[model samples]
Each structure stands twice: as C-alpha cells, then as structure tokens.
Target: MRILTVVGARPQFVKAAAISRAVTAHDQSKGDLEDVIVHTGQHYDESMSRSFFDGLGIPEPRHNLGIGSTTHGRQTGLMMNALEDIIDLESPDVVVVHGDTNSTLAGALVATKRNLPLVHVEAGLRSFDRTMPEEVNRVLTDHVSDLLCCPSSTAVDNLEAEGIVDGVHLVGDVMYDVLLDDLATLDSMASPVDSLAVDPPYVVATIHRASTTDDPKRFDDIVHALTQVATTIAPVVWPVHPRTSDLVGGLTVPDSLHLIDPVSYHEMLLLVRGARTVVTDSGGLQKEAYWLETPCVTVRDTTEWTETIDAGWNSLTGTDPDRIFEAVDNSSAPETHPPLYGDGHSAGRIVELVRSLPH
Candidate 1:
C-alpha cells in the first residue's frame, strides 16, 4: 500500500511522525507498505520545519511545495496547483491528510479531483464557529474523506450530525500516540526549561493565532495578562512563532515574559510537562496540555477539544485580560487523567484501517 501523506504545520509533523513509525513497523512485518510524505511548507522557517523531522524521525517529504505565508485562498491554491502534479506523478492509492489547515483541504481537493481515496486523520473535529477557518476545513475534509478517523466520541458525534456516517472510524488521537512514545525517553533528553533560566512552577504561553495576534487589542490584552501571571502567579515562558516574530518586536515586553525562538518537538514536550499552566490559542496545545495534565487556559472563546474542558482540565477565557490572568492563577486539573483519545497504539489501528480500504 502506497500512502501519500500531506503535512504542513508543526502539529501535523508530530502526527505524521506517529503514522510514519506505524508504517515502518507494518512494512517490516507485513511488507508492501509505503508512506510518502509531501511537505507544503505552510510553516516556512527552517527552525520550525526541519527540526520537527529530525526530532520526531518522520521521513523527509518527497516533495516540499514551499507554499509559505500568503492569504489563505492563495496559499491553498498554490498548494493545489503544485500537489496535483505530484499526485499524478506518484499515483498513490490513498492520500492522507492530518489536520484542518489549508494544506489539509488542499491535499483533500487534489486527491478527490484525481479520483483517489482520501483518508483524513483528526477528522470530524468542530468548534461550531463558521467564522474560524479550521472549522470550515474540518467540515469540508470530513465530507470528502473516504476514511474519517476521529480522535474522540464528540468528534464522531459532530460528523453524524453533519450526515457523514459512512467510512467513519473512531481511531484515537495520533498526537497521544506520539506523546506516549516520547514519554519513555523524555527524561533522558536535555531540558530546554533549564536553558531558559526559568525556575519550576512557570507558565508556558504560546499565542500565535490570527484572532489574538492580528487583533491589536486582543494581543495587547494577552500580553498584559501574561505579564500579570509572571508578576503574581509564575513567570511566562513563551516560544514565539515565526509568523508572530515581526509583531513581537514593537511590543514593550517585560523581562518576566521570556520571549525565545521555537524549540524542537521533544523540547516542547518537556516544556509543557513542566509548566504550571499552559496558555495558548493553538488547538494542538490544548490537547497536549490535557495529556500532560497541565492546567490550560485557552485564549479563544471556543475549542474543538471540548472534552478537555468537560474533564475540568481546561478553561476558556477568550482575550479578556482579567479572565486570562485569573484562569492562570486558578488553573487546576482533576485527579485522574483518563485516556480520552486512546492508548499508544492508535497508529497501528490506523494502519490496519488503511490496509482494509479497497484500492
């Protein structure tokens, strides 16, 4: 089985890593399994892009589209134009896309256009807000995917309501699979937190969403709230995203708000695990925080991973400064961290499902 996997963003790299490992194992044991990766270059920076491949052991993409920062429509259009040819040349049996980024939808469109089966991992997720770009991508991808592997029951419920019942499977979260595998070796890896000069019981903040950074008011409010947390609760260790690098320059950042360059996936796992609380606008971070059992304060009003909130592990505080600061101070998770996604074997299950699909 030849599977063409399309990945663009940082989170997608981690998910792809899990699937890649599964494919390697399947190839060794069962034979005739190939996982071909295509990098869309949505995350353009070398630090953000190459480090993930090295850190996670994902096979380098056969094609890197280099579809860097642009308007959403143009970026996706460029990816589709480039990916269509790759699809034609490679002639893959199944095209698999990871998350709800423009890359995901672009890959989905090209696969269906070529009349190939499309398998969407992390499918059927919804924040129910049509205004969010991710929400739209998830809906469109789920409708077109031949196999919709959902991470949670809520995601499956979302798909059922949207009238997508066929080819839907309750596969566990691929992120969890990667995390579980990493946990065994994480202690041996050198800690990034120590290099930051930050002590224990610190808050980790990752605010890169357009909703927070593009809006000046929200960005300023988030900064002020993070400063508050640093002053009162704990120091905020923020790894600035490459997209947000320019915007971070003009701001009057305090010393307490330690703004540093992005770290590798392994470094990130260590950072989150040691954090007193995690504050982010990123969808992936919410689940990572929940998995790490670290209290999470989402800067957005709604989250696709509502199960985390329902379990008393996460809180929604939008861009309100008071709420953001308070949520950090009062951040506390429940006693038991029940495995919401699945055990460390989701990648194996996904491989089995893909094998069963009629080519």
Candidate 2:
C-alpha cells in the first residue's frame, strides 16, 4: 500500500517524521508499504522549512508546492489544487495528514473528493470553539477521515461525542515519538545560545498563532509585557517566528530580550531543555516544555493540551502583563510526570495497526 503524506508547517513536519519512520521500518520488515511526502510550503523559510527534515532525519519531500502565505481561503485553495494534482498522478491507496492546519484540511478535501481513504494523525482534538480556524479544520477533517489516530483518550471521547464510532484508534501522539528520538541528538549538539549570543538562565519565548499575535494591540501588549519582565535577573531568548516578526515590524525590543531567527528543531529542543522557563503561545511548545521538565507560561486563554496544566507544569497567562509577570515569578521546576500523551511507542503502534488493516 502506498500512502501520500502531506506536511505544510513546522509542527506537521515534525509529526510526519514519526509516520515516515514507521512506514519505512515496516516496509523493511514486511515489504508491502510505500510512502510519498508532499510539502505544501506554507512555511517556506529556510530554517523553519528545510532544517526540520535535516534535524529529524526525515526524507526530502517528493514534491514542494512552494505555496507561501496568503489569506486563509486562498492558501487552502492553492494547496487543494496542488495536492489534487499530485493525487491524480500518484493515485495512492491512502492519504495521511497530520494536525489541523490549512494544509491538512485541503489534503483531506482533495482525498475525500477523489474517493481515496483518508488518515488523520493527531485527530479528534477540539478546542470546542468554532471561531478558531483550527477547530473548524479539526472537526471537518475528522468527519471525513477513514482512520482517526488520536493522541489521548480525551480525543477518542471527543470523536465519540461527535458520532465517529468507527476507525478511531488511540495511538498516542507522534510528537512524543519525535521528542523521544530527537532528545538524544539534541543533547549532543552545542547550545544555540552560544551561537546566537543569548545567555543562559533565560526564558524562551515564542509567539506565532494568529489569535495571539495578529492583532496590533495584542501584539503590542505582549511586547510590552516582555519589556517589563526583562528587568528580572535572567534575560529572554526569543527565536521569533517569521510570521510574528513580520506582524511586529520595527518594534523596539528590550535589551534583555534576545530576538533571533527561528532555530532548527534540534536547536529548539536544546534551548527548551536548558531554559529556566518558557513563555509561549505555541501548543506544541507547551507540551515540549513539559517533556523537557521546564516550567511553561502559555500566553493564551485556552489550550487543547490541558494535561500539561493539570500536571502543574504549565500556566495560562493570556497576554496580560500582570499574569505574565506573576506566572514567570512563581514558576517552578517541572516534576517528572508520566506521559499524558502516552508512552514513546505511538509510531510503532500505528505501524502495527496499519499493517493489520485489511487491504
């Protein structure tokens, strides 16, 4: 069986590595699986894009559509066209997509229209807010997917509530798999701080999502909070996301805040591992910080990964200066917690499930 895998953003690229390794390893043993990777190029920055594959050891994509940024509808439409064209040519038995990016929604639509079976990794995640584009994408993609591979039992219950009874499997999180595999290599690499000129005992900050940084007022508020908090002993090491940097052009940064370009996944892992604390709006980073045993302050009102919150490792500060400062001041070292996302064998379990499926 051949699977067409689509990845468009940095997080998706990271998760895809697990699935890719699963397919490759399974094929090596069972000799019946083939995989093709397609890059939507939604995040086309050199460090953000190419470095992910290199850091994670994922194979190069078979096709790079090179569809950069645009309005939501336009970007999804362009991706649909490109993916449909590729599907027509490759005619794979299954099309696997990860997460709820525009790319995932586009790929699901294309595959469903073509009557190809669809598999959604990290499926059934719901913020229960229809206003969020990602929530809409998740709901739509889950509705269409032939196989829903979920990370947590909460996600499976979510699918059940939505009446998706069949083809729902709790196979844990692929990110956990990637996290386990990359941690060793990341530990071997030199710290990004030495190269980027950022000092240790720093708080790592990352802001990218539209809801957090798109609005000028909200962006300004976050920046102001960072400035206020910079007076503390430790500095802030912020590897700015390309999108957020563009939105906050020419904004003055506090001297204590070291703003650098986005680092590679391994570099990011190292930074997170060594950080005194992490403050971010990234969902992935929240979980990653938990895994790295770092205290995390999320600059958002809500998070899908409430496991981190329940474990006392993460706090939602919601872009409020007082909350941000308080959270930072009160942050504590993360105690080692059991994997809420699951044990680090999700990829292997998924591979076994795929192999057991009737052809």
Candidate 3:
C-alpha cells in the first residue's frame, strides 16, 4: 500500500512525523507499505519548515511544491493544480491530508476530483465560525474525507452531529503521538528558551494567527496586552513567526516581551512544557499546553479544541487587554487533566486504517 501524504505548514509536519515513523515500522514488519510526503511549501522558511523536518526526522519530501506566501485563492488553487499532476504521476492508494490549512483543502479537492480515496487526520474539528478560513477548510475536508481520524470523543461527536458517520474512527491525535516521543528527547536538547535569559514561572507566547495579527489595530492591541502581561504577571518568551516579526519590527515592544527566532519542533515542545502559562491563538499550542499541564490563555474567542476549555486547562481572552491580563493573572491549570487526546499510539492506528483502504 502506498499513501501520498500532503503537508504544508509547521503543525502538519509534527503530526506527519508520527505517521511517518509508524510507516517505517510497518515497512520493517509488514514490508508492503510506502509513504510519499508532498510538502506544499506554504511555510518555506528554514525555521518553520526545514527545522521541523530535521528535528522530527521526517524523510525528505518526494515533492516540494514551492507555493509560498500568497492570497488564499492563489495558494490553494496553485496547490490543487500541482497536486493533480502529482496524483496522476504517483497514483497512490490514498491521499492523506492533515489539519485545516489551505494546503489541506487543496489536497482534498484534487484527490476527490481524481477519484482517489482521501484520509483526513485531525478531522471533525469545528469552531462553528465560517468567517475563519480554517473553519471552512476543516468542515469541507471532513465532508470529503474517505476516512476521518478523530483525536477525541468530542471530535467524534462533532462528526456525528454533522451526519458524517461513515469511515470515522477515533484514532486519537497524531501530534500527541509525536509529542510523547519528543518529550523524552527534551533532556538531551539544549533548551530553546535558555538563550532568552528568562527565569522559571515565565509565560511562553506565540501570537501570529491572522485573526489576531492581520489588522494593524488588533495586532497593536494584542501586543499591548502582551506587554501588560509581561509587565505585571510574568516575563514572556515569544518564538516569533516571520510574518509577525515583520509587523513587530516596527512596533515599540517592551524588554520583558522577549522575542526570538522560531525554534525547531522539539525545542518548541520543551518551551511549552516548561512554561508557567501559554498565550496563543494557535490551535495546536492550546492542546500542547493542556497536555503539558500548563495553563493556557488563548487570544482567540473560539477554539475548535473545546475539550481543553472544558478540562479547565485553557482560557479564552479574545485580544482584549483587560480580559487578557485577567486571564493571565488567574491562569491555573486544574490539578487533574483527564486523558484528552490519546495514549500516544495514534500513528499505528492511523497507518493501519490507511492500509485498510481499497486501492
């Protein structure tokens, strides 16, 4: 069995790493499975892309479609056009997509159009906000996927509510599978936060989501709120995204708000694991913080990972200064964090399910 995996962003690489490792083990034992990685190059920077591949030991992609920064329609359209040809050339048993990036949407459209079976990891997630592009991508991808690998029972319930019962499996989170493996190596790796010179009980922040940073006014407000958190609550260490870095370079940021270049995948997980509180709009970070038992103050109003919120490990504070400060001030993770994502074995299950697909 051959699986063509599509990935274009940092988070997808993390999730794909788990599946790739599972495929390697499967090939060793079963000797009948091949996994082809196709990187859309949505995040082409070395920090965002290459570092993840190197850190996670993901095999070099079979195809790196250099679809860099662009308008959404152009990015996804270009990916679809290029993927159609790749699909025809490879003719794999199935095309697998991860998360809700433009690349995921593009891969799903091309695979379905080419009459190929599609597998969507991280499916059945919904913030119910149509205005967000990710929400649209997730909804559409879930609808078309031949197999929907859900990370939690909540996600499964989401799919059932959408009347999407066929081929849905509770395979847990592939990211959690990777996270568990990566956490073990944290002791060997030099802490990514060590260079920042911040002490313990410091906040770790990543605020590069478009909803929070695209608009000049909103971005300024969020930066201001972060400044306040740093001033009164605790120092903040931010691994700045390239796009967000450009915007922040012009702003008057505080000394307490330490900004640094993006770190590798394992380095990031280490930082999150040790953080006193996490502040971000990134969906994956929210879950990582919950798994690490770190209190998270999400800058977004709504989150698809509602399980974290219900578990009392995450708080939403929508970029408002008072709310942000308040959430940060009161951020305290619950003593008991029930098993949310999985048992760190989703990759094997995902590969097994993919193997079951008819060619």
Model 1's lDDT to the true fold?
Answer: 0.90
lDDT of 3 by residue, 1-359 (tens): 88999999889999889999999998998899989999999878865687888888988899999989899999999999999889888888899999999999999999999889999999999999999999999999999999999999989999999999999999899989988887778878877767877887899989877777788887877788889989888898888887698887776768988888888878778888888999999999999888888999998889999999998999888878889889988988788889998899999999999988988
Which candidate, 2 or 3, would have the higher TM-score against the true structure?
Answer: 3
Instruction: Report each candidate's C-alpha RMSD, comma-separated, in the order given.
Output: 1.0, 1.6, 1.0
> Model 2: runs farther than 4 Å from truth?
196-199, 247-249, 334-336
Q: After superposition, how far is residue 55 of candidate 3 from its true place, in Å?
A: 0.3
TM-scores of the models, in the given order? Answer: 0.98, 0.95, 0.98
lDDT of 2 by residue, 30-131 (tens): 888888999999878876787888878888999999999998899999999999889888879888899989999999999899988888999888777787
Please estimate how well model 2 matches the true structure, expressed as its whole-model Cα lDDT. 0.86
Per-residue lDDT over 242-299 for candidate 1, one digit per residue giving the tens place of the 0 to 100 score: 8788988877767778988888888888899999899999999998988888999999
Instruction: State each model's CA lDDT, in order.
Output: 0.90, 0.86, 0.89
Clash number for each model: 0, 0, 0
